[model samples]
Target: MQDNSPAQPAVDLRGVVKRFGTMTAVDHLDLTIRSGEFFTMLGASGCGKTTTLRLIAGFELPTEGQILISGQDVSDIPAYQRPVHTVFQSYALFPHLTILDNVAFPLRVRRLPRAEQRARAMAALEMVQMGRYGDRKPSQLSGGQQQRVALARALVNEPTVLLLDEPLGALDLKLRKEMQLELKDMQRRLGITFVFVTHDQEEALTLSDRIALMQGGRIVQLDTPANLYNAPQSLYAAEFIGETNLIPARMVSADHGSSVVEALGQTYRAEGTTASAGAAVTLALRPERVRREPAGTGPVGELVEIDFIGTDLRLTYRMADGSKVIVRQQNSGGIPPAIGERMPLGFETDSLRIFTS
Candidate 1:
């Protein structure tokens, strides 16, 4: 808190690196998190998302570089000394302590008065709607309730930043979705910076203001959910963020703000492609973007199978060139597909993303 720069970021990592023996867990990482930002670190297992989080939490000191909290360097500070609190997958609540005392644990550690601690703990529980259960033990609460109590405990400290390491990972599908919304709402209400680490793509996309997709100890892409999904810069990013068909294409023409490419045995115009003529590239098109043509008017592709996925239908069509194209059709007041010999698929020009090889 001592060091102040003009409008400093809430959390800043300057070329941060963490190594365990010969293996580097976090690479030369540089990140700046603005105040009240909900930044998520997303990746698969062993992709260093959690490690990067620990580096920020002061649980694991970086092997190199500096960590700044609100512009003050805190690289050498211990976890307890840092103005941050962590909520892990495991609730880690006290089994023997009452809910109120559990939430007040941090204040108790700081030697705060019992009256003030109780007041803060109750207020924290109220935020999570668990004030009624203040006298109950953690063992008496359900999984979701316990998780909320854990959140209450972490929030009672009112730290400069809140680090969540897959806190909703332990919940079931329904509960997890509910918790994701609740957590995001809480962050907005508190107006505190949140550094969340999760492997779940849907969770990251739904809750994060911006996501850092890490791979092999490095951030592969850092952007908003829509931008990362729509305009990925690389093949890995395009494929990893969501379901998209990557069609190999050759750029036949390039123009300002738009380009034409040959894909799937046909010519297609794409926008935002910067490839020169005759450049080989991968064209990304989402299944939802592919529209269905009237009976015989769409691309002539044999109907393979149609998957009825509740609200939407996914049609797998085999193109004439032996390549399969997946089409997502909305079940919106239209007759479903029948077993036909061939069907057609069309999409908008802007939906086609061109990535040069």
Candidate 2:
């Protein structure tokens, strides 16, 4: 008989909750990370992203619920017994040891043969492109190089899953971007499940196959980067992922997949809604989705301010009610509307996301 069932998730958190004295860090979170998937936990500081990572790492035990790895109940297991390794923001390498010895430290502690340790450690270094620096001391390498060595050390044991706790946060911006590409490539090539934690939304969008955006100790939204950005289910999800214009609106009517909302003294057809007729709602419109139309063609506003952002122009418009709406257009080297000039704004039907206030 052929087994057609889905494989077990590399890591799973079932009804997980973590409390710190009077505060709850993770509030009954149920999450499953599939094998070889790049899953990211994303949120601001104190949003429980890091706390969730620690719970999975066994550094912090959950106050309630079960933690599983490879379909096994590991809620009671200690960190050393878990089939996972964590790479922290700070590359915790021993300065006294050479790169090779640092990578071999884990195998050494496991009491593998000296030759086997050396061979495995060297292979791990090569995997991260730091093989040539095997003999160099940690102090002799640059920050990026040191981070690569640290990654090699973590990977040397070949754990089923790799937990990265903002491992690229310590690097400079340019280097961090470079490492992001490399990390994604490495994950794909090695086919290892990566459970990454980061507060940086851009980083999460760039590196994750799926992201869980957490807020107040719960996942506000969990989806692919594009869906999280384009089809945000809540105001928090829309506002957190990128720049958005929150227009005060009132729901006019609603159906299964669409809704009509009134905003800026005009009616608009918006994507899915959770509000009923005449209820107060909010419209989340991304700046880039806004179109500039001739004055009086659509919802009219006066251009109030303009800023030249590289590759794009950020324009602020003042509605009659004095509320401001921001619009972003690509820099095509054309003359922009003068400040104080009146212009109409256009929105595609799919661009407006309506949420109940």
Candidate 3:
């Protein structure tokens, strides 16, 4: 049969669902990944992120709904038959084969001519900056080199989409950071769709053009890194994307898109208006936004401890009501307050996010 799938939207999942016995792993999920875009699925373990990736790779069939690549349904298609490739976290290279052979294995399986396979393998190796190591066995290379070889093997197929499942999870911190940049660069140069799965929020924010935050088998939020960090839509999203301080507050009054909240026995004007009145709410504030001021100007608190974090300082203060609040200050110039010193903590009204609990 001639393949008549649309040559766009590298991947599209419509009402995708997967179940294991009585528990549903992926619940009625719908997603669309644009062609040539670097997309990421981020979530904790057992949140169905990997299951979604597996379903797209055809490693696991969905119980219901359709998986479309380029607009053609491939829900029941086997992994080997699909024009997709996966680079796993564990660099699954053949230890006995040379790097060149490992990269050429896929082409050989398709029975390509020897000359064509050799040329393609060398090119793939060069693309991953491993041309000189093509003659070396996978056992002889370092972890980073082996990972590059794995990536080269996946790229050699010239597949429509490349799925990476924590491909940098094995490398050291420095190497992982370097690889993140390299992978993004390679994706841009190749113009191929990349669906990356990672639980690290920093990695996702740094690498992906957009991220889908998964929670309990569903997508809680999907947006760019800046949007996800600056304006999270829910409590879970705010807490997950980065470090945040959640302060319990109550909406006392609101006017002209601004509301006043009573938090920690102090009334402060917040930026946004909420629908519910007399409701318990939480204000999401970043530690860096909380500023230290003179004791007489703002909320009074006693500095309990100061933590030196090399480039910054974290100050913990205890309010009269016995609530602990953390403030992160840059270590550029000003000397931090001594322990047991009294100070006023002031935060901008615009920085406060009022959300219903």
By the TM-score metric, which is better: model 2 or model 3? 2
Model 2, residue 5: C-alpha shift (Å): 9.2
Say which prediction, candidate 1 or candidate 3, comes out ahead on lDDT: 3
Best by lDDT: 2
What is the overall TM-score of model 3 with all chains considered together? 0.92
Give candidate 2 regions above 4 Å deviation: 1-6
lDDT accuracy of residue 227 in candidate 1: 86
Model 2 whole-model lDDT (C-alpha atoms):
0.91
Steric overlap count per candidate = 3, 0, 0
Error of 3 at 152 (Å): 0.9
Ranking by lDDT: 2, 3, 1
Ranking by TM-score: 2, 1, 3
**Residues 78-122, model 2: lDDT tens digits:** 999899998988888998999999999999989999999999999
> Model 2, 238: alpha-carbon shift in Å?
0.6
Assess the local accuracy of residue 180 in candidate 1 as a C-alpha lDDT between 0 and 100: 91
